[model samples]
Target chain A: MSARRRLSLGERLVIAAPYLWIGAFFLAPMLLIAKISVSQSVLARPPYRPIFEPSDSLAAIWAKAQTFSFDAYRALMSDTLYLESYLSSLTIAAVSTLIALIIAYPFALAMARAPERLRPMLIGLAAAPFWTSFLIRVYAWIALLKDDGLINNALMALGLISAPLQMFATTGAVVVGIVYSYLPFMLLPLYAALERQDPSLREAAADLGASPAQVFLRVTLPLSREGVIAGALLVFIPAVGEFVIPDLLGGSETLMIGRTLWNDFFSNHDWPAASAAAIALVAVLMIPLLLWERARLADEDDAR
Target chain B: MSAPLLSIKGVSKKFGAVVALEEVSLDVGAGEFFALLGPSGCGKTTLMRCIAGFESPDAGTISLSVVDLSGVPPYRRPVNMMFQSYALFPHLNVFENIAFGLRRQGGTRDAIDARVGELLAMTQLSAFGHRRIDELSGGQKQRVALARALAPRPKMLLLDEPLAALDRKLREETQFQLKEIQRLTQTSFVIVTHDQDEALALADRIAVMRAGRVEQVAGPMEIYDRPATRFVAGFVGETNFIEGRLDRNGAAALVAEFGRIPCEPGDLPDGARATLSVRPERIGVAREGEGIAGFVENFVFRGETTLLRVRVARDIVLRAAACHGERHAIGDSVRLNFPPGAGTLLAEET
Candidate 1:
């Protein structure tokens, strides 16, 4: 008789699939980027030097790796442009996430409280933006924000402005673009949290002599906190690394780390510097992301 | 009871085309434990919600101490409800959940703490005050809900199937605890439940409802022993319904398949069809010469009581609930008789 233990091949394969996918797709690329970030940039075949050649001996490879420099990262630190860009990207992302949250919360509440029959349609509408290409959507924002475009024209026609206001290529325009694109991300989780809430909680609050505003403040806001955090993270993470929206709709004066990275990689051909910037961006994002995950685990434990 | 503390008058409500409540009126005296009992979709819950001010009636007024409560919102109303689901705040600890109503009323910190501590003791959840709501058991959560609803010191407390979430044994235990709490608080309680046993056990008076109307309202014993309608009789407990015709005009007797049986007179004309509703316990095995003869068709042992079905003359079956020690096998010859005043004659439902 066989011993009554050990996983079967199929079970092992199923269990290992997600880890393998993350290892191959995420960790491997990250390691490669880290390796490239430490290498010297030169006008060469791969645009970077000191490749870990297959023919090199183990000792030779180790010795060559030791010769790797922190020049790219050091250059980024020495320049205030990178620092300002990082700060600006963080600020813009924070502002946009807050705005999206404020705007999306009421809409999410409305969707959650909508009649059951209409809920599916409301969700479909929230998700409808994903059907179109994100690039096309950002480009469409440009047409509306430009001085000669629809918004300014409408303002002029309605006698709201004279000599067409400077509407395009501004920080405000970039914020609008990011908010427009990420509003759905901010809305869906909130709707899920609110919708799953038992309506009786509100009634129970009211029954306890809490006025409408007090009920909202005491019960509704605190209960949907999980969704609020989830929605904020969803919007903030991508907004921090957003490239296309700022490139299309923002002015030259509005500096973002994404645009800086793009310039390093494409315009200056500084592959190592761009890789360093990417790593820095990842490091900046990791702290909050880890905190959020820990909070989620703690919440699950409390629920159990 | 003195003048009713809460009076609901001519309250009618409709949801689109469907009538949820129809001119429902009820009076709840101070410190009375009242129950709205019915099957699902019988408007018991709707009536409770109306009283709680969650749903407004389209056409009438609810008064507390003779003050009309027409436009008062739920938050402004002097009432609180323990929801069927408990609805304990998942984000708050037991202490905060119980203290929420007091905090909303803007009490001083010390007063809030004292009140919450007192409620925690009252609900027997003093140790659980520090525990998160999600960490509590179902029974503990129910106590938290009860404590939270009672913290505001409302004029009336409403419970929507407060014990519906518990298992049978726990439900029975909670029913007694709930009654004790109501007595101790001296606050009028209006509970809505579909469970007849719960209503019978916990309530001082029960309003049995059907399809958006109150069918009968009376004490438990009255509802059980002397139901007003055929619906109430069948709905509350097990009974043997014997259809019969009124033969003689005045003595209040029914001529059924078994034989002529004495019954309480109802609203029925001479020679009109009626039903003799006799509780299963009222019928007993009698001597052959004294009562109608029948054979025991089958019997079921129900722990405390043994139920037997007897096939009498004309193949008519009558159910009798006897004590467990009374042994009767299938096909055993038996005679059944109804004790005087044991059965009631109800007019045949149209």
Candidate 2:
């Protein structure tokens, strides 16, 4: 008799939970930041002029909105420092992601191809870095990268160098820090993709007269492409907005937008400019995200 | 097995302490549909892998047409295998998957296309050439795997349980189709399977392996009618095993628990303990005859045929298969006889 269907309360909650969480956390903060990006920076408390007040009438609010300053946006456009910082961040992230991918791919392949009993231990080892404090780990790199640090001492002790290398406070050191910290993020996805593949496929290719190199190029590479893309995105997205690594490792010359945003917020007390920079970084990250989604949907379509 | 296309001699492989294969030797002739049949842990699959060069034997030489392939890698060997999972590339289309081997072997585009197109037609998957591997059905994937493996026209093809994933109906249909393909292509095939019916149906010769050793290697009917060992007798088909002792002389009655059963002691000494391996279908069941009289203790319905367990004496039962139309209830009096040339005398297993 009850032909028409209605979702129960529990069913509705289960379906609505994710959207609610995203709306409350992700979208709301984004909207707040966007609003701040258009406001005028001020020397007074809170560092930015209020676009609207609770006591303002509708007409007063409308007038305030019309006079809202676009100084932060205009500053980002005209200043070569902001432009160079953005470019530097993009280049550094791209370089670090590539380095992490190159280093993690073989390690992941070795773990996946290890004996069955050893796989769990290997995968656990890949995730072992997460157990340690990330801040302490980054600080550890500082000790190694300083002018008279452990690395320079070891090289001198080995008689491989006559003097200490200028490793710390350089762009190379920042790239190294980013690669080291994001290595696991790059490794786990690749391991999953490689491990999920049927070993018989490699054998099948080999049996079909493909050499080891050929099998790797034709079968192994093409199949793990999803993991490659996924791992690249995971490392690139976070590295683009990385704040601590570049700050600790690079000199004042390393112009990353993330450090610029940090200075605008904490040191200079330019909240509007910082919000604008943060919003621009988010916009930059959207390109890779949209491309990732398109690839995933295309894969699903092929499967269908 | 003269001038075999694939010859595996004294092949031995071990996994740590487990002996997967032990000095196994087999020869597959040109155009022969050979099957390695066994239960789990029987090394049939290990032997197949050794032949395909996936797992190298610790000590052996596999020769294809007289070339010793001792340390040849799987890629260097001119042989192909159809995996049980079909293992088709998920990213490639059907035509591309079939053409992969040809491309690896280095051929012109037109030549690879012609070969792939011809194979697609042979497998009746011409319309599905453009379909992605995941988009096709299981049977179509199986055909694609077959076509892909056969693209290079290797000296031999190894199939690892080709129909193990299909249902019974499809398995039977594929059996005939596989045999037809083998015949049409004249390709020597060495298929490994745990299903006896599959081996019996598709193989020209069945090599029954047990515990890392080949127990018997013979034609299907020969293996059924004349099993060389007790393990082969029990494994290949359903049979009624009557344990007994041979009389003082040859060509005499076997003194069993029930009564004196006539049997030929092939090579066993007089007074040697033996077992009369009589196939269920070989025994005749009738209402009255000059055979041993017994009461039907139980009957198992199997489609068109019914297997009747007749007790000739107390605790002495013998299985006899009859047509489903033959109505025989429990406690019905009947006579059973093991016809001549149907029962084989095998020595008791050690």
Candidate 3:
């Protein structure tokens, strides 16, 4: 076991490969997007070309000189349709996250207090949706909410409603879809957090003379705040970028930034505008993203 | 004198097929510090929980003064428990933690503040009110737990292995503090502990338990001096049990035989099979020519005293304690003497 042999090339490569892969797939793509955001848009091309110049001296070079412009950002701000869609997406995401949290908290609490023999089964039930295709689940919601579908059919058959209800293609339908899709994401983390909490703390609160409501308010809620925050972040961040459910369940009344951005890139073939919108969305989410990252780091620190 | 402040009658609790407590009954007099001492599987904690209203007995009733606690929840019970973990709420500061009970009782802000302040001062924790529970030391947390439990001024306080978490020196010091607090408040306290020294030091009376049954319930000195059963005698302290049979009849002194000395049993029924229990400190080391002779097998030095294990016969070891500076080395021959009435005869287990 010589020192040089102990420091084997294969072991070092095995340790360094994960960082390399992360840099190539995640960091490199993000940097490339940043670079493309500043480039001139090409006309009638499937993929937009990057505008770069070798030198500034020659006439040809000057003709092809890449001009850095904030015009795309200016276009993004000026477009009222894009701005409203962005705001609507943010609102939908926030509202759905709140609703998901409201539903998940009690479910998580019940799961946490359930007996040991029943705990794994409940957790599996909460997580079972994630194992199936998300798209199919969202599509299933369309059948449940559409006119002459299950809900309307049952309502009419029971004489609860005189006619079929128009539920699909509304903002409410989009919210319902997003909440249903993302609810399990909120629940798992909340359950994990609540389950790890010591039951002794509640006993201590009771012994200290706290009523049941006071115990939940003072001890249970505060102790589970980290989990609540984490669950909210998990549900909100992805829902803000979600387009599938909104496109399927929502009618023309739903104009989320995700669907609009997709239409801008694929339908309109406006790469610069789409890239500009993506950059703006990133900028809009920067503060929360940073806070969430900080929270995650703090969680890691506490674990260590 | 007055009726017991807290009384438990025929308390029997079972968890499915396992019986945690079986017809257990005890009374805690006002201002008395009582202890339930037993090993891990014993019903000490179960009894404490039953009194704290965390457990309900299937065949008995618990009462405080004259109020029956049949359907009372823990929060409504006139008793509080200091859990073994010192289960402090990690989210609340010390002041809020101590004020928790008072707030629940619907006290006004000023009233809660005054009560919390008084309890803080009483527990010598006035300066620690702003500190987080995790920031405080173990002893500090213990004091905070004590103050929190005492804030409501319940009729009785239950402690579950209160001093088991402390180091030896701290445990001894806290034992005195606990006794003093109990005296000052004049509140009945039922402490559950497995440590015999803790039980003996802090208890006015101890209920020794074994396998969900009360083995003996008596004052500390009485329980120690005259343990009613072999298990009680062995569990409470170190003792040497010598097999013997009652030799005499009537009111005459009962005598039993050892290997050499015809050991006179202190006082027991004649013709009964018994085991004589003698504390190591009660046995005296005699000079080589004075008493029944034995070979010293080992001598363990314990700072203030030396314990000598003597071989009186094949496979028979007798223990005697000698004070420091009056030394006896291992491998030396020694004689053992039992002063009159120093031994207690325990009935043989069925």
Candidate 2's DockQ:
0.78
For model 2, what is the error of residue A94's alpha carbon versus the real structure, in angstroms, after optimal superposition?
A: 0.3
Candidate 3 residue pairs that clash: A169-A251
Model 2, residue B300: C-alpha shift (Å): 3.9
TM-score of each: 0.94, 0.94, 0.91
Choose 1 or 3, whichever is better by TM-score: 1
Model 1: CA > 4 A from native: A1-5, A43-47, A298-304, B247-251, B266-269, B303-305, B323-325
DockQ (C-alpha based) per candidate is 0.72, 0.78, 0.51
lDDT of 2 by residue, A1-304 (tens): 9897999999999999999999999999999999899988888888887756789999998887886777898899898888999999999999999999999999999999999999999989989988999988988999999978999999999999999999999999999999999999999999999999999889888999889999899999899998999999999999989999999998889989989999999999999988988998899899889988998898787776
Pairs in clash, predicted candidate 2: none
For model 1 chain B, give the 10-residue run with minimal summed lDDT.
Answer: B284-293
Model 1 lDDT per residue over A78-126, tens place = 9899999999999999999999999999999999999999999999999
Locate the minimum summed-lDDT window of 10 residues in model 2 chain B: B248-257
Q: Native contact fraction of candidate 1? A: 0.89
lDDT of each: 0.90, 0.90, 0.85
